[model samples]
Target chain A: MTTNDFLPAAAPVARLIQALHKLPGVGAKTAQRLTYYLVRMPEEEARALAEAIIAVKEQIILCSLCQNLTEQDPCPICTDPTRDRTTICVLEEPLDVLAIERTRCYAGLYHVLHGVISPMNGIGAEELKIRELLMRLNGGTVQELVLATNPNLEGEATAMYIHRLVSPLVPKITRLARGLPVGGDLEYADLITLTRAFQGRQAL
Target chain B: MTKPRTINTEAIVLRAAELGEADRLLTLLTPAHGKLHATARGVRKTTSKLGGHLDLLTRSALTLSYGNQGTGLATVTGAEALDSFMSLKADLRALSKALYLGELADTFHPLEAPNPPAYTSFLEALQALESPADHDLVLRSFELRLLDLCGFLPQLARCVQCEEPVLPGGHFLSPAAGGVLCPACKPSYGDALPISVDALKVVRYLAANSLSSSLLVNVRLPLHRELAALMSSLLRYTLERELRSTAFLRAIAQQWPKAEDVPSRTA
Candidate 1:
């Protein structure tokens, strides 16, 4: 939704600019600049961009099992039997799956919560994929559930809540180990993370 | 060329929602500025220095530069976290209450309106919750004070319609009428919740007394129910809408039953 009627140029170009403005981080001026740039583009690139956006809207469906955005029903990872079916690493967003996948840390399946329970922003557990995750857990094949939500208040709250909801029904539930990031200055670290690192210290 | 207006305030991060690809829209409740929404650019990226200091429930001193036009969302140029309340990190119950306090403040206070009273109450409330104080009392006191400050202080001792003093016994609370109603006038309102005199006294005590002092009032379980119901209806009547945080908080309350036994630091 256009907030406070920010854009009012009335042309199709203005509509494009407003649409871009609605997106996160794109300021009004930047939105206009991008729109004008897109108008000047040699037709195929612009058509391709438009079609790609349309294709995502028309083709992408939430994976029935994991709730990750994909073109297929169960998504590739959920359908793969070779993957470690023993664990399910839960995340706050589809992007988080990519972030963890890049680390090549584990071969477990994934569950995307889509959003955290943040009431200040009107998000709740009912609005997320927690119920689907619970249904997935009911199959009993999953043993270890890793809560890998972002290290923020809402993320932590979501993790705690789901942990409460799923702990009784499952064998074990785990959270990503908190510690100092590599190459980080210890002095600059926030007290919370630093303290967590100390509390969960490891033997070298 | 004239420079744009810049505002500086010490504020707590009430809430943070994603604004754009890599930015956040923050609701900051400040002593002088009340609750203001500012845009922290590039905050979603780990490289963004401003991101860490703006975590939920963190209080920080901020310098916001209203962009050239001196309109729309202000840009957060500088931030220094005064306190991160790290104690709340592990305790999920405390975290929920802390978040509730933030959302409660955000809900009642208006944008850019200076409400030092509400701001002070909010900061104190956060500190109390972070202390893992009796959340029920903390929340009740905060709600009472918030109502008093926002000009929604419900009348306690008198009847809304008859203008007679309500005796110290079970009475009807007419939120629409903005106070307690004596039995004589109870039939005048379509919406009235039964509230005990003890509950009214507690609300009056909370309204008249400072939050820290009001926390000392030991409300029994039955009175607890009465006070909560009365205040919620009062809040809904005054705010004209249900506060979303209360529901979220209730969910957390159900999750952690032992939250009631959480030791108060002051106690």
Candidate 2:
């Protein structure tokens, strides 16, 4: 349907609809639905939501050490004494750090590059936090550098570039293994992923 | 209601951007379609079958269905990799160069138009990059050939201004004038950059020969620098903007040592 059909006649309501529509995955219908929902919500609850958005925008800052978004300079993860300071897992974004943490598998520090090397988008290694990561490595306390960049082409390129640069300094460097996802059918796995899985296969 | 139209074509993934969650907006270059913007639904999810085949710089056979009616965007129904250029992607230097070539092709090619020759040239260039051939020569040849295909080929043998045949000692290249300038014409063009005779000969050779034959002409580091500078200037002038990949390629060059020279071909 057209914008006129979905957007409220009121200027403020229409404006809210347009703003909500700009959010990723929000269509005109979804935006209208959310806008109307907000309009019906209790004033206190709506105020809380607005205030939370403001708090996030104003209070959050990139962690000085890991470059992940945090309320503090060196985030809790970076300052955590339980973390293995000798190993650092490099990732493309802060969301990735959360994903890895969900597994409760590793206990190492993380350095978020904030983005991968994507030349098509005009983003290069310089646009990333690679320099900061290198500076952290130069402290000479880190013994292992785990490249946890995505399995995509841009991610691979970023990882390779970092590996080339940091190989000499770090005692060990490793890449996250690529393969079929857990619970995914073998027949559904893509050829590249399957190939990598076979290449990285381990014996029981 | 009319049935949806579907066409299967071989396409190279020129660029990809994230669309609403679990989907991707891809800019593809096809021999028949030239350039296309298609939505690959669910391509971002872990289970997407299209994800591996539709990566940037990959040539894949794609089945596209135009069913969104007014959107003018096609949805990818099926995809299989034709050539992933795995060897090229394995090396950071080669991968950067290949992406640069893909960007150039995307820039020169227009959407929804057929450009089989340009498409073929691009595919061949990627294949050449995947091989152990000279990276510099492959790039130069691709640039020259693509410019020729797009009718932007710079004048190398003759002066762009005086129309006199260029003498083989030293000349100036004016990207604005769209080619090399003879000694007499050099004074007229203030933007003309000095070009060595060796660099001129190499460019001319690359422009004339196929990618394989072009690789036979061994380019020393100094000459390669001259050629690269001249080509970069010409491209910047043509596009009226600097390509993003150029800086990345330059950074890659500075980080990695140059590959050893290949032996000059005898025939």
Candidate 3:
């Protein structure tokens, strides 16, 4: 039975349950369990949780430069002087920006498109933050654009499309290398992956 | 609780939406089930084996098990790509039109309904799109044929107003009124667009003939515009929503003028 079937949980508790269930992957059972857990939690801890949610809602905004969510308009990364400014890495989502940041190798600025082009899903170039990326190129400061979209059909298509649109404005454009996985067997690789791996083979 | 049943079917990926963190919600158009929406667990992860086969516009044989949790969502257990439509994927313009056709099929075809005619229409439309040809003409023919197959064929054979036989001449096409109107009924629907006899004839021909024969038929620039306008109006009335791909296609058409600027068809 659904958590709602528990006969109209107290208004506040029911609201909290609904809010929890709205989060991704949180089903009815998990929502009810979490609500009860919160009820049992110390008053200070629960207040801290509510306060953290409120703070995030109040403080978080997209950085004016990279479009990444942050408390400040310019964000810490955008204000950092140690990062390379000559190159910019473009990605489909803010999550990708985080993924790349975790690698700790790349030190360039980033431009988040917020989404890739997917015609089947009715998402197009107009829907993305591509114009913001283009506007960042106006100063003739950034020399290279590293397209880091996923290695799938929609991602490839999006990269290619942005490349065409921005090629005239930039000096060089590069794409994330596509090849076979590190631990995968060659025998099991699909035709497209195998072909890309073969075509992109590097010399020792 | 007893586990839900699992079944297999051949299908094409019409749309894929990200779900949870690593899974995808796939809208698959199938022959037996019409339009199906299922969750492919872990598909967004690179390590997932089913990722490649479930991409948008790719056809695959899918094994799906109904969710016993009463979520009304099925889980894709396994899948294999049957047709990749590689060339269409490579070209931007072709890809746009192909995806437009997919969106149209998804919109016009209802969920959980087994409509073989609409299903086969989709199959043939994708096949027709795979070949190199006039992308717009191919799309128009696909739209008209899909409309015909879906039983939304506008009453073109006669006056939709009075059911009078329309002669092979000038007539008005009305979206709200549903089809071609004679001069007598034309004045009533002021919004009715003028449709030349030749344009209506070509549209009828495209709808009735096989994709190959439709490709062979030559439509002059003027006739082509009329046909395109008529079909677009018919589609807007039937679906009542704008096709998303049209904007992207319009952008490309504006950039590459000659390829999209329709004149007369060769042969």
Candidate 4:
């Protein structure tokens, strides 16, 4: 067939665009742009990108204890000796462990639930890494659970769900905090803060 | 040392945000109090002891030292969990719903109030969620009961304008006017949306009982729709706008298979 006759009828490109659009926060236009970008990328770069996708599925295994995606069956965080054995910080995703670590804070080990409890969305407590978390606590070395889920709705709910389930098993459970962002301005604060500011008023 | 306030109450973790370099703040829903904010000092530290005990959705018996701060904040002294709700985190659908409810609770309930009934209602809702039996009904019951506690009861048993006993028939829910309207009263109500008789039955049933009761498990789709409609109307009436989480809830509910019917592929 001639090159003109064999010209791509947008189907292959359209499929790529559709796939990109399905990703979190990627709109259709951005997906289209990304698809076009990929189509023009160097052959080596394209091969590398494709290989990376294959590699994740090929190499990534869940940490046996925490259920987090890891190259090793027992992730480095779970295996590290210096990490606290008496406490575990439960998170919704593996990336959250990274977020806490970025702050240069937290020496305790981690457990990734992979998700949170959400009844309206049809998720319950049984689908998470909670059973494994409980099992880890059974040894009695773990004394506390720190819920490091996101600050949003699902994050808070997941933390509470874990707390309720583990309260009887673990002696201590705690959550993250909220406040005015560092360097944030008073003029930009919303009612939640305006209320906090009023409630935490200072005496003249 | 003074004895810390050792209280036993079921709490919903509402929100968590980072504080100072090594501290975290939490909003909790207590069984004896509506909502409260507590501080976990040094919780962000590498060696902080309170880290795991402070996450969201964890129901715990807390030992709090009521801080004398001008803000009336409670400092978490000790914590022990009662249930982990592990099932919720494993499934995406359940996870989304739990988060949506947490958002709703955080939005509607005030932070400082000694509202024991509100606390109990929330606990019952969470427990109902721990299993697969009638989750939709549990949520609907919780919403209706919450509105009732907040002084926004739906006019389920009778017509809004005529005051006549509402019978099974074509009905419309008017959020602006507040409650359902019979066929005769629909036009006069100005903005009533269509509702089925079954929905009204569910609404009335939910409105009549405590959320913890078994009556919730009896609800089916028709009743589910009705309770949802009624709650939508009531919340719109009270808040004067729609909650952002309502859309998410609707989206998730659409993904759920019809009652007693599994997806063909799964089956």
Best by lDDT: 2
- For candidate 4, write residues B200-235 as lDDT tens digits: 666767777876564435766665666667677767
Instruction: List runs of model 2 lying over 4 Å from the truth.
Output: A1-10, A27-33, B1-4, B68-71, B259-267
- For the predicted complex of model 4, DockQ is 0.03
Candidate 4 CAPRI-style tier:
incorrect
lDDT of 4 by residue, A47-122 (tens): 9999999999999999898888899978988898998888788888888878888987788888898887554344
Cα lDDT tens digits for candidate 3, B1-267: 543477799998888887877888889898887898999999877777778778888888899988555347889988877787766776666666777888888888878787877777777777877675666678788888887877888888889998999997768999888789998899888779988878888877887887778888877777777777777777887888778776766676676556433211110
Q: Each candidate's TM vs. the true structure?
A: 0.88, 0.91, 0.90, 0.54
Where is model 3 chain B poorest over a 10-residue stretch in terms of lDDT? B258-267
Answer with 3 or 4, whichever has the higher lDDT. 3
Q: Which ranges of candidate 3 are over 4 A from the true structure?
A: A1-7, A119-122, A185-188, B1-4, B67-72, B220-222, B258-267
DockQ scores of the candidates: 0.33, 0.41, 0.27, 0.03
Native-vs-model 4 lDDT?
Answer: 0.68
lDDT of each: 0.81, 0.86, 0.80, 0.68
Ranking by DockQ: 2, 1, 3, 4
lDDT of 1 at A39: 91
User: How many Å off is the CA of A66 in candidate 2?
Assistant: 1.9
Ranking of all predicted structures according to lDDT, beginning with the best and ending with the worst: 2, 1, 3, 4
Question: How would you encode candidate 2's per-residue C-alpha lDDT over A70-126 as one tens digit per residue?
Answer: 998889998999999999999998999999999999999999999999987799888
